[model samples]
Structures are given as structure tokens and as C-alpha cells.
Target chain A: MAVTMHDVAQRAGVSIKTVSNVVNGYPYIRAETRERVEQAIAHLGYRVNVSARNLRTQRTGMFTLAVPELSLPYFAELADSVIQAADENGWTVLIEQTGASREREAEVLSGRRRHLTDGLIFSPLALGPDDLPLFDVDFPLVVLGERVFGAPADHVTMNNVAAARAATAHLVALGRRRIAVVGAHEGEQVGSAALRTAGYRQALEEAGIPFDPALVGEAGLWHRSTGAETMGRLLDSGVEIDAVFALNDAMALGALHALHARRIDVPGEVALIGFDDIDDVRYSVPTLSSVDPGREQIARTAVELLVERITARGEPAPFRRVVPDSRIVGRESTGDVPAGAEGRVVGIQPGGVEPVEVVGR
Target chain B: MAVTMHDVAQRAGVSIKTVSNVVNGYPYIRAETRERVEQAIAHLGYRVNVSARNLRTQRTGMFTLAVPELSLPYFAELADSVIQAADENGWTVLIEQTGASREREAEVLSGRRRHLTDGLIFSPLALGPDDLPLFDVDFPLVVLGERVFGAPADHVTMNNVAAARAATAHLVALGRRRIAVVGAHEGEQVGSAALRTAGYRQALEEAGIPFDPALVGEAGLWHRSTGAETMGRLLDSGVEIDAVFALNDAMALGALHALHARRIDVPGEVALIGFDDIDDVRYSVPTLSSVDPGREQIARTAVELLVERITARGEPAPFRRVVPDSRIVGRESTGDVPAGAEGRVVGIQPGGVEPVEVVGR
Candidate 1:
């Protein structure tokens, strides 16, 4: 059976012109009228193929993206890339921060606001399976982040466990038997912290090394200060560790500051590694080694998925779980040096067993 | 003549209960219906004294705040303080980011979305006098930032000129005869850049120092990298500056980085100061001195003003222009120290003129 615009108009109790207006983004339509038309379109599974409709309607030349917080450097850099990508697409992006709150996340999902945007790339932090019912929202919504499970919307995220495992493996490869993990959530069953912790254990198990409970330092917030506090506490508790893995760059920076304050030589006394290859890591004191979580790919894919959903309304595509690969960035902090280096050599103590193969020069 | 609820209901063609729902934030009412009631209330100039109405509506328990971007630390900290202040008032804050776009700013001004929250504290970066007509929005809105002029909404901003002047005067007070300015916009007549530039000139005039055009560095963006680039360019151009006043902490950081790269000694050879007392200032190598722009006060006052208007219906209270005070924070980079504090001078050189009036340690 073929679905038609007339059927949608009848179901929505709106004129065909009103439906057209809603589709075309004519701003004068009342909010309620637009909401009704959108609901009808969704109910009827009506889609206007954008590639074809674009010739007739002309491109609005706009893209919409929503994230948790911009203040977080990772997200800020991600936004910078997204804007760059959107620029390449000849589109300008409108950004919204959801603050990772449930109510706000729900509001973003509701297609009621679709009239204000062409489509949305949403990165939700607080929404999960219990809120899956809200995925029926009428607009194109591409979800990002690891907080939600079985999300009805298309999603893009990083390979959290694999990446964490690889990061920990890198430390183990450096012959560091005692590695401390920062930014561990004490009791969370899900989320990035838990997955990363699992990956840490996997790496340790694979290496035939014992995972010490005391090596896991808990940081409630992933801020730099939290990282420093966690490190300080670990030191205060007389925990001896050769390397530290901070869950994120900010925490890693805090750890670096704490180590510096205590005059602990990086890559000699303690090797420091951080996740999230944030821009500042390139210029930090002993340039941090980190995992590039493919943030750029996530942003680009999220946008593409949202656009597809917006253009293919009736076609119910299966939810997507995109796991972009991660790579370890070797730097001074991880004792990576190229031939003919111009700086002083920070000697490491002998008798520390080296594991796996070292790739860095 | 006294305006009554009956008159408002008669004009709006809605039941008194509907009006009550609109006033009380009963979410079930359709957005359009709520708008009509609000319009009627505004047209009738009815004022709902919040303190008086608090007895009836026990839920003055939430407020909405909108800023341009949360990724910027300044706005992030501002939002944090605003949330804290609202919490102190027994209220939760709902935050939204406009990405500092004019269209989004206009959308916030239009009362179309007022039903979602009781009042709005809007920080506009893109809106200006040309958009003043939109300021006639019916709901309570308190505007934050220096971009918009003559807006009917209440405004909260820093004393940019005075603060910048004071910052410049501090450099002069330290016997820096040739001071440079970073983060200057080339030809802007308004905005923070222009205001701060004016203050710089005022300080030079008072100090009897000739303003050197070559000493002013223009940056494409206010980011740290841009500040560094601008500083590098100024140095390359052979401008002999004994001091620097960066417009913001970001630019100041860039300047610090640039100075470090050039092997220029801070405080001893060239003193440095910055605006916006951002948290990062405390962590910089030579710890930056900056002006505290009273952002927390601005956020709190903006919320208070919006709440006042929200409860007041459409009584048209006089627009408020809140100018938050700024104070100088003296730090290592400024070469100012407390009396009787003698320490081993490692990298710091002697014979630098000291500025006594700086407040920071």
C-alpha cells in the first residue's frame, strides 16, 4: 500500500499547504499547527527524499548539533570539528547544550522543537533505556555518548572498553607493573567509567598480571582538580604505582600537576597517560600520551545519521551502535623518543619488565 | 484605574483557570493558548508581586538561564555560580545555550517559548541595537552582556572601560612606560574590545604616557593561540613594549606562552596583566594577574531581575543596567609582593618596579 500526503493531511486535520509549510520550514505557522503536522507526518511515516525535494524547496543551508557541555575541552574541540565539517557541507551549525539532564534530554528528543531546526545531532548524558519511549519523537535525532542502552535512535560512540584496554596495555608494554587508574566511579554498573575499568582488568588479565584494588582511584568528577585530589589521596594512602592512567585529559592534567608538585619525574619515576587527545595535551609540560577516541568521526556520523533519519521518515532503520576505533598517541610522558633528540635523557630504573612491543621511537 | 483578572480574562477570551495555569506554569496548556493569556496579561499591565504570590504558588522553585556557550570557561563558571545562587534561593536552574547567534537570541526574546520556564536570564553575544524591536517580548527577560544596546530588558554587565583602564594604570604604576594591548579588534566601534581599548587610552592619558599605535596588537579571536600569535607579530614588528594588558585571561595566556617562546622575562623586563579572573590564571607558569569581572553577581542579579518581571506580569518596571565592579588581582607576573616576604629568587631578576595597589597575592 502506498502512503500519500493527502492521507497524512487528513490524519493531521491540517491543510496540505500547512503540511508543506511545516516541511519547508516556513516560520509563520503557529507552533501547535506545526506540531500537529509533524505528528501526522510521523504517524503516516511520510518522508520527503531530501536529494529530490532539495531541488524544489532549496537547501535551508543549516545543520543542528546538541551536546552535553561546551566547557569540557573534548566537546569544545568536537564542536570545532563539527563546525568545520558542516562548513565543508556548505551548512552552518546551531549548537545546543543539554547539560546531560533527563528532562532537558527529553525536551531535545521531542519533535516539537523540530520547526526550529532542520535536524539534530544529540549527545545525551543522562537519558537511558527507561526513557526509550521518548525516542518516538517526530524529528531526526542522532544520539551520541554511552549513557543510553538500546537507544531507539541512531547512535555514534567510541570503543570505550577496547580503548581503555589498549591504553592500559600500552603502560604494561612499558614494563610498568603497578598502574593506577584515575576517574573510576565506585559503584556505577554502566557508563564510560565502568566500561573503561573493565577494559583495564581485561588488559591486566591478558598480561598475566594481578589487578590490585588499591590501584583504582575514584574521582567523582572528571575535572583536573578531582584528578589531582585523587592522585594526592593515592599517594597519601602509600600506594606505589609506576604509571597512571587518567580516564580523560583534564584528569590527566590534574595528575600531571600533582606529580609535578611532588617532584615525581614523569616517564622515569612514573609514566602518565590520559584518554581523550585534547588539543592542550600537545603543548603540556611533558606532552601527554592519550587515546584519540575518534571524536571527529562521531560528530560527522551523528550529523549524517540525523540527516538520513530526517529524510527517510517512514523507513524504520534498526538502531545503530557506532564504535569508532581508538589509537594511542605516544609522547614524552610515555617515554617515547625519536632518534637524535635534543633534550636531556630521563633514565628509567632497570629490572622493570617490559611487556609486548614498543611502537614509539 | 485598577486592572483586574476578570478584565484580563475577558480580553484574552480564556477562562480564569487557564490564566492561572499560564501564570502558575501548568504545563498541560498548549503553547499558543498560554501565549494568548500572557499577551492579555501584558496588554492589561498586570503585575504579579512574586513575594505576595509566593504564598499561593509554592513553586517559585525553578528558573531558566540562557548563555551563548558553556564550553568557554568564563560562561561555564558563570553558569555554575548562577546554578549555585538559584539553589540558594530554593530554585533549580534550567540552562540553554544559544551559540551566540542572532536568530537564536531573537527566539529567546520572543515569548513563544516562555511557558517552559517562569522567567529567563538571557546572555546575548550576537544581538545588538538593530534587534531592539524584539525586546518587546512579553515575558520577563534579563539580558546579560555588552553587545545589545537600549534593549527594553534588564541588563547586567561589567564595567569594561574602568576595569581595563585600571589594568593599564597598574602597568604604568609599575613604571612601565611602553605598554602594549592584546586582543584589540581592528575597527570595531562597540563591544568589549572597543570599550577596553578606550579604557587603555584613558589610563595612558592620566599617566601622561603617549599611546603608541604599534604597541596595540589585534587578534582574530580571543583564544590563547590568537593572543600568542598577536604577541609574536607585535614582537616581530619590533615594538618595544615593557608591559602588556591582555583583554581577557585567554589572550593573557597566549601572551604568556608567546613571551615564554621569545625568552622574554615576565615582570622583570615586561609586566603582564589580563582581564576576566578565569581559574586557569592560578595555574599558569608565572601565575597571571587579572580583573575579577563580578560574573557571579551578574548571573545572580540577572536571574533575580527576570524573576521579578516574570512575577510582575507586564507592569513595565524600569530597565536595569547593572554594572558589576572589577578588582585587580596581583600575582607573580605583575611582580607585586606582600611586605616582609623574602624568598630565594630563582628565575626572577631584581630591580623591577613594584606596583603597590594591586589586590592579588
Candidate 2:
């Protein structure tokens, strides 16, 4: 059974308006009357009816966060940060898993469920530049990631190209010449895959290393299995690689498994690095080196921007694109481990990616 | 800007009632009128007012899924499955992260935000048997995991004790006698850690091996870091463990890392196993052996039970506690690799935990 304010009011021998006033913290209420109402409220276990209040105010006190998938550690951690940020802003989050489907991503932006929440934070994976017009919907929407660029909505994203270049450069700086890139998409340009691929080529070009197309392993889904499969393919193809850079941490971790399976010594024989510094990177064997894409910052900024748009009245503010700063977190995989630090797990330094001291087998 | 039913009605040159009928798919609507209304709906980009409809229906078509944390792979995967199951039922999911705090868990059950969702599927980690009264709330709920028992709600849980025993037995079957249990809570009389520890003791006793208190590694949080710390402690203590059974996969994976760091050969010097069978285990180097605790089935069953309770009217149905089947998935960590099989990822068999045919290093 739901406890109502009326029940509390009846118990307190006060009018519903009086009870409401007490609940809303009307400072003018007599201390004695407030005390009685409060006691009744406590006794009845009454809570303010947020839905009723929201209906009158035309705000749900809720928002939708649409991500590709939660099982993926990156999105999971992102969702965690977004929820935390939303909670701090006194809002609840309803998660919508689009599964990276174009149809579902379209439905999320279609204003089909606009009345359900005050606004939406969308991360589109399948819908790219061609679907940019779909972002023209009249709703409080904040876009995430390097997809559907220049959407007419507040955008919060990481510098995928810059971060990818930094990751590649990290590998190059390790004196590894034949660096293979895992999780490359075949043909055309756009989205994270293309942008990151461009960055990888940039690092290679800067290093004066000839871009070998054979070293580029193409994979779909960017899943760990695909990463492993791609790495296995690269290894089996007899591509002499001294280092490997995967687009994201998932693929990198998979590649790590593949390397380990082959008994290849990390950082000794082949330096490795990844992007999107998910928590898994820290726990992986030998500890993975990855690009800290400022996930929490991105989430906080997205929530803040979405809330700003949701509560604003009349003239809408000009949409702005936000790109959070990202850095490379070097661990054992990238020869960043300090000697004599075996069996020790290094902790992250706030606001910076420090070279982790240890880990292995 | 939300497109209203009135906008569609105006554009279609029809009454709002006619538009409503068309939207609701009333069979009596004329084909020509329906076509005109559909065109108007598509043109105006109108969507049904779910909030308005919910207000009248007194149901939000949403449910809350409260887990400890999403950053953990187990919870992330569970949340994914739960979201999928909820989606299949046409219900939106609102996720609440309790952070495993007793106060937050209590607040979730207090019905303070009851109107936000139709029901709750809570997987509590903090609140135990002493908090039984908290679960007596009137809302539709489905309790998850080995937390408080006999709560006045439908429950969907995995058999923690049995699953843990099975995992330990698998290690014993591999001729491991000096088995160390990682992630045990000291003096824990209830909950997962306790149940799993009991299962470990049972397996050891059954195997005619004496239980060693020194082999019980206590960890507060069943995190990967904690698992690593515990395993490191156990190894440093010179406990002479021939096997390790981490309570869950996160800790097991962590323990795996610790063993790797120490150059301890898994399934050679030490056999290893874990519970919950999170996706990480499959991707981990050497591919960990773990208990497949029917996580997907648990999610599906919990959603099914909660929805039944939510939609039921009048007299309440008898509370049911459904503990799904669980089995051991053996991988390289337990010497489950088949002959001459390497450089391949093993796929899971439906409804069964198959011995993985390959993995490495």
C-alpha cells in the first residue's frame, strides 16, 4: 500500500494543504504544528508524491540514457558515471539499450517517448553522418561519442582521433617499428573506427614508417573475440609486428589474450596499447596500457548540458560540442612498468594517466 | 518540442477522439481516415503521450532494477540481460545503483519513490537477514541473490552454496587437495561469501581433505583488486595451496592475475575456479574455469516473476523462490583444454557449461 499525504494529514489532524506546506518546508509554519505533521509523516512513512508534483510542473524529474550496450565495459562504466551525475542533479535515469541498431537509435530520437522523461542522452553507434538530419528533432537531447557529427544537439565526446594518435605514438615511442593496428574497419571514413584509423596512420607517417595495409586487421563489432580473431589473423598471416594498437580497450584486451596464448612476451617482444581506459585494462594480466578518454568527465558534462537544455525556457541556447581531454595511461603492456615492482597493483593518479608500476605472468 | 495528438488531429482535419482511435488501432476507423491520420502522424512526428496515458492507467510501464554497481562486469552483464528481458515485456527499466550500502538498500525498499516504477528487482549485497522486515513493502518486488531470506516477495536466485560446491568439486576432481578459498568474509554467517565458503568446506570435507583456516582468504569487497590482494596474501603466507576457488569470477580473474604475476602455473601448480561465470572469465588469459550460475535465466525469471506480480489484481499469488540450475564451465585454468587445441576461443553451449576446448600460454 502507498502512503498518501492525506493519510499523514488525517493522522496529524491537519488539512492536506497544511501537510503539503509542512512537507515543502514552508518556513512560516508554527513549530508545534510542523512537529505534529512531521511526526505523523514519520509514523505513516509518507513520502512526497514526486509524480503528482512533476505532472503539475511539467517535468518528470527523470531522463533517458540511450547507449549501445551495457555489457561492454566502456558503456557500463559510462552508464555508471552518467547515473552518478544524474543522481547528483536530483534526477533518475531510465536506460535504453539501442543495441547499436539504426532503427532503435532512430526511435530514441523520434520523440516517440518524449513524454516519458525530461530529456535524453543518446550514444549512437550505427547511425552516422547520413542520419544527421534525424537529430533535428525538437527535444532536449545530448549526443555522445564520435558518431553523427554536427548534430543539432549538445554533443559530449572524446577526441577519438587525437587519443588514437596518442596511443599509436605511445607504441612508436617504445622503439617498435612494425606496429600493427587491430580492429580496423575496411573502406570509407567516419565514426570512431575511421577517425582512429586516420590517427594510427598519422602516427606511422610521423614515425617515417611505411603504412603497411597488411598490418591493418579488419574486424566487425570491435568485440574482444573479434579483437582476438583479428590479432590471430595478423599473427597467422606472418605479418612481422613489433607492437600492436587496438582501437578500443575491449579489442586490445582480446589481442592481449591472443598474444599471451602465443606465449609472446608483452613490452619485451611487442608493445601494446588501447583506447577507452575501462576498468578492465587495470585488472587485465600484465595490466593494459590505454587512453583515458575522460569517461566520467564526458558523462558529467553530458548530464549537465542536457539538464541545462531541459530546464531552459523560451529561446534555446546554441548547441555546443564538448570534447573532454584524454591522455594515455601506460601500464605493463606498453613497457611502462618499473623494475622491482612485481606483484604490485598501481593505482590511478587523479587528473592524469600515470605509468603503472607492475603486473604479469 | 513535443508533437501532440491535437497537432496530428489538426493536420488530419479530424477530431482529437478520431486521432486517438486511430492511434489506439480501433478497428471501426474508416480506411481512408486511418490513412489520413497516419500521414498526419508521420508528417507531424507525433508520439503517444506515455506519461499522460500512465497517469490515467496508474501504471508507468517501467520497473526499477537495483544492483550494487554496474562497473563490475557481473552486474553489467546482469543489467544487460535484465534490460533485454524487461524490453521483451514492453517495460522500460530504471536502474538504481545502491553501491551496496545498507542505507541505500533500505531507502530503495522504503517506497519513497514508489510511483516512479511499477515494481522492483533488487539484488542486495548489504542488507541481510536482519533486514527482513524491509522487504515486507507492499509493492511488487523480486528479490535477487543470496541475501535476506523469506522476504515477502517473489525471489530469483542462483544456488550459491551448491554452485560453489560444484566449482570446488571440479578443482578436487582435478586432484587439487590444498584448496584455498579467496574472497571469504570472516565470521560471515549469511550472504554469498558465507554460503560459498560453506560450500568450499563441504567439498574439502567430502574429498577427505582437512579445512585449513590459513587457506581462507577474507576480503571485504568481492572486487578484482581484493581478489588479487587476497591471493597475493595467501601466496605470500606459504599456505601451499594446490587449488584456489574464488567466490566469484571477478575475484577469480584477479586471483588469476596474482598467480600470473607470481609465475604460478594454473592447473599445474594450482588449479583454479570461480563462480558467476562473467564474460571476463572467457576472455581472460588461459580462460578461467567458473560456475555458470544461470545469470541470463535468473534475469529472465526475475523479470517474468516481477511482471506477473505487477500485473496481477486482487488477491496476491503465493511468493515463490526460484533458484535456477548452475554448472561448472571448465577452461584452461582447470586443465580443461582438449589436446592440440590452441589459438581458439571456445563458444558456450546452450543450457550447459561445456569444457572449453582451447586457450593459451
Candidate 3:
């Protein structure tokens, strides 16, 4: 049913190595011999088995990106950037959706790691410190974005704490004090929610303001519906708020929806900001101010790190964490009344939070 | 270095065939023999060569999805749905980005076809009539969306003409006389843009309205920027339009941006509508009205078709075209003043529009 390399070699009346050289685009092969092998391959309908070649070369020339879901625009955009970076390095990307399931995330390491790809660039939303023992498997891997901290691989993520502080500080700088925070996951430790919340508090304390427990809004997931739902709950809590800082852009957009439904003018009686500067924010009615977490940099750094580990397979394992710089991008959301402010960096992390250790791109 | 099957066979004190049978989950072998083979495999850290197995079985149990880019939410969601469908049938998906280039689309047919996957589910944007002949390849393929109209393979697409007509008629039914269109490709013959435009004309003709060329906005890509730029030009052209029907949701969102920038009210002085009910459309400020083109149905049909072709490789070469049913979903954009209309079917093609069908799932 399928032609093998041996069949092509037999048809060409040449050694299998000669036929392999022709198929591999080896310049050393004689023109006449190469032509004969090429003709034999064409006649026999021979397909070079990439995985079999990978077995021989010990390199698959492919990588897998395991993200939660593509329906989320942030992950989708992150995938786009990762694929672009992978393409630049001459690799095809295999997409694996986990849907943020703990079982599925663990299965990726145990089941799909072998004989599939050279390395994996994974972003987990489910598995956390409890799953670290599973990461002891002998595989070249790079982790990205939230969960599985202290994994034995290169970890590329945004400065969530620093970036959140900047976002909150920006709203405070605009003369808004009573800010509500949306999309806080319950009992989160090192996740994006917890870190961002810590930064938000730091910003409040720096401004000589006390942290109010009622200002924190709980969301089941970082979805638009949840954002709106949680914000609606916050509004119904009877807590007077003059500003809002949702963890991500989707929740912020959702918060905007809630505010509009309640007949509140954005950035007039209340200022607003979100994280993860997705492109849609640019076209939103009032536009949106957000923390640009350097997603492209995350993608490039993750892929580069994975490639490095793949090429240097036998090297001693080095635990690396690459944190990209971030800042608050001001837009119409944080503007004063009739304020269509130009996009400016409203806040930056003090001391340039690019972590002096580990490699920087 | 990865362990080989020969080592496992050696350790098991059995023939390689016996070990292979155990690894392949073939149940004919004795339970005792299977246990011995499994223990040997576990001890030796043996991994079965998937490509070598593919050579023997003539099936990789995998599929490739070649789209222009995943940055577009439509393709990303389509990929998600395709992966979901494939996973149900026990298959992994490989993603290949073509960057919407004619050369790259053709290359997939030639270069990436061999020894990669059991089948390919492609959504080509750049390839047209000139590349139709390349579709006659040995690999099993199912193409999605509006391109390569008469290729000798399975096609699963939305009825663009009918869907577009339905969208336009929705606007017309809202009592908007002068309707402008955004995202018309320049001189396209059988693409989505051309089919959609033709449908818009058909709807206008049905209403006894004249086809005004000035109302058709030209755009190179169906992106937000192009949608806004074309709508901006339409406004600057002084063509008095009471409504707009953009070809896609992204463009419609962009048109909203331009309208917001110009201080024109949506669904007030001018009504608006778009196609492809992407999730973001639901969250847009005015909540855009769009034609639900049955994206999940398209993905399911395409993957199912490719799987059918893979399983029944030597069956009669029946060229199937599965056109899923589409309906217009109404939101604030096309609603009467202060009207948030519920979803309704504005138009349905008589006889169900299955002119030439191969299989419908």
C-alpha cells in the first residue's frame, strides 16, 4: 500500500544510502545517480518517513504547543506568536488542547512526550506544585504561563506582579482611589491571579490606601461571561468604587459591559484597566487601557529555550526563569471625562524587572 | 538516546514479532507471552517507532490541518473544533500555517503530503483555479471554506452566497434602503468574497432594488484594519448609505470603530450587520448581528470526510461537497432603535441548496 525506501533503492538499482542521499538533498550525490533515485522515488510514490528519519537523526524538527483552549483570544494570539517563532526556526507546530484539565495536563508528560516531538512548549492552567514529580521525566521541555512552577525546564512568563502593580498605580495616578478588582481565583498561591492581586495591594499600600476585602471580585474562570458576572456581583455588593482593575482584558471588557448596563460612564465616574493587551481592546468602543505582558517575547523566549535544550540534550539541567518586562498601556478606559488620551506608558516596574539572572532576549 | 525494539526483544528472550504484537496491543498472543514482552519493554525503556508502524499499516493515525494563520479567531476556533472531532476518533492533529500564500498552499500538496499523516484537512485562502490540478494528489484530503471550487476532493464549506444573501436581506428587512458592503476582494471569481457579494446582489434583486457599485467597498484582506479603511472610504465617497453589511465579523467590528470615531450612531442613523458569528461578535459594544455560518458543522464534516477517505482508501473517488445550513443571528447592530433583537431566520434558500452533495453528516 505504501512505498518503502528499500523499494526505491531497488527500483533505482542503487544502495539505500544513495537513494536516501537523493531524497535528503545531499549535494555530494552525483547528478545522474540523483536523477535516477528521484525518478525511482517518483515512480514508486515513495514518501520519506519524517519520524523514521527523526529516529535516526535523534531530532524530530517539530514541537508541540499545549495550551488550554484556542477560543480564548489571549491563548490564540499566544499560539500565533509561538508558531511564528517556531516557523522562524524551521519547525512545524503541533497544537494540543488541554482545556485546563489536571488529568490531561499530566497525561501530556507521561503519554505524548515520547516519539511525538523534539520538545514541548506547554502553558498549563490546571496542574500546579503537586504535579512537579511527574516533570522528572527525561524530556526536553519548556513551560509557559501559570502553574507547574519550579519545573525542571526553562520557564518563560510575564512579570504578573510588577505588571499588575503598574496597572493599579495607573488608575490611582488618574485620581481614582476606590478601585474594584475582578477575576480573582480563590486560594490561588503562585498563579497569575494571586500574583497580580499581591501587586494590586502593593500599589494601594504605596499610595497610602488600605486594602478592602470587598473590592476583590471572584470569578470561576477568566472568561468574558465570568468577568461580567463577577463585576455585576461587585456592583451589587453596595461597595462604592471609583475605578476597576480586572486581571485580564476579557474580564475588563466584561466589566465594561456591566458598567454600561448600570448606566455608568467609563473613566468618568470610574476608571478601568485590564491585563493581557489583546488586539480587540484597540477597537473597543472607548478603547481599553491594559498591561502589555510582552506575549511575543514570551513566545520567542520559550521556543528559543526549547530549541537550546533540544540541541544540547546531554547538558546538565539548569532551572531557568525568563521574565519579560511589562508596562501599563493607557487608553480611553483610564481617561478623564471627554478624555480620549493617547496610548502612553502610565507605569513601569521600578529597577527594570528583567531579572538579572537567566538569559534575556 | 532512545531505546530500540530489538533491545526489548533481546531482553524478552523472544522474537521481535512477539514483542511487536504485545506493543501493538494485539490480543491473539498468550497472556503469559504478553506479560513477558511488557516487562521487557518496560525494563528496556523501549518506544515503538510510530513512522515505521505507519509504513507497515499505511496509516499514521494522525491528520494535518493547513490554514493560512491561527491569528485569525475563525481559523483558530475551526482548528479547535477539528481537534475535538479528531480526538473523538482517536487521532492527533498537526497544524501547518501557510501564511495565505499560493506557493505555500501548493507546497503542502507536494512537500508535506508524504509520510506525515493519514489525511489532511485544509482551509486554503490563497490557492485558486490555477492550483486546482495540484489537488489531485495521493494523500487523503478534505478542504474547508470557499476556495478551489471544483477540486477532486471532499469540500466542507458554508453556503457563502446564501449566507451572505441572508445577511444582506436581514439589513433590508430592517428598512435600511441604501446598504454598503465592506471586505469585497478585488476581482475574485469563486472565493468567499465573490460568492457573498453575488448573494448580496441576489437579495437586492429579490427586493427590486438597484445594484449600486459605489456601495461595494474594496478590501485586500478580511482584517479589521481593511474593514475600517474601506468603510472610511465609503463614508468619504459621499454615498448616502443607511446601513452596512460587512462580509465578516472582524470587519464589522472595525466598521463600528470607524463609525464610533466619526460620531455616527449604530442602528440609529445607520444599521449594521456582518457574517461569521465569531464569539467576539457577541461581546462587541453594540453586539453585532451576523450570519451563523455553522463553523462547528464545517469542522466536524471536514474531519469526518477525511477520516472516511483514510479508512476506505481505495473506494470510488466521489467528490463530496457538504454545505452546512446557515442562519442570520440578530443583535443590537441591525436592531431597531434600542432594540436588542433575538436570533431569527431572515431567509432560507428553497430546496435546502444541496445542489451536488456527496455525504452529509
Specify the CAPRI tier of model 2: acceptable
Per TM-score, the best of the predicted structures is 3
Question: How many pairs of residues in model 1 come into backbone collision?
Answer: 5
Model 1, span B1-361: residue lDDT tens: 5675556667898755467668767778898898898999999997654433432243334556777765566776787677766656655565666667787777776543444456678887777766665564545677777777666567777888888888888888889989999999878877889999999999999999988899999985677768878888988898788999999887887787678666788878889998888766654546677888887777777767766776674334667677765678777678864211211122211111112221111
Q: Higher TM-score: candidate 2 or 3?
A: 3
lDDT of 2 at A35: 95
Pairs of residues clashing in candidate 3:
none
Q: What TM-score goes with each of the models?
A: 0.68, 0.77, 0.80
A258-280: candidate 3 lDDT, tens digit per residue: 78667788878888899999877
What residue pairs are clashing in model 1? Answer: A70-B71, A71-B70, A71-B71, A337-A361, B330-B360
Evaluated on CA atoms against the true complex, candidate 3 attains a DockQ of 0.27
Candidate 2 on A1-361: residue-level lDDT in tens? 7786657777998766577678766667899999999999899898865545445356778888999988888998999899899888888777778888788788888664566678899999989878765676555888898767676678887777777777887788888889999988888577888989998998889889899999999988878889889998999999899999998889998898888888888879988888888877777877888888889899999999999998986656777777777777878888787421332222232332222211110
Off by over 4 Å in 1: A1-70, A76-140, A169-178, A202-210, A263-270, A282-287, A330-361, B1-70, B79-122, B126-139, B171-178, B205-209, B262-271, B335-361
Write the candidate numbers in order of decreasing lDDT: 2, 3, 1
Model 1, chain B only, scores a TM-score of 0.75
Clash counts per candidate, in order, are 5, 1, 0
**Compared with the true structure, what per-residue lDDT tens digits does model 2 show for residues B1-361?**
7786657777998766577678767678789999999999999889875544445357778888999988888998999999899888888777778879798799888765565678899999999878775676646888898877677778777777777777888788878888999999898788889988998888888889898899999989988889989999999998789999999888998898888788888778998888888877777877888888889999999999899998986556677777777777788888887321331322232232222111110
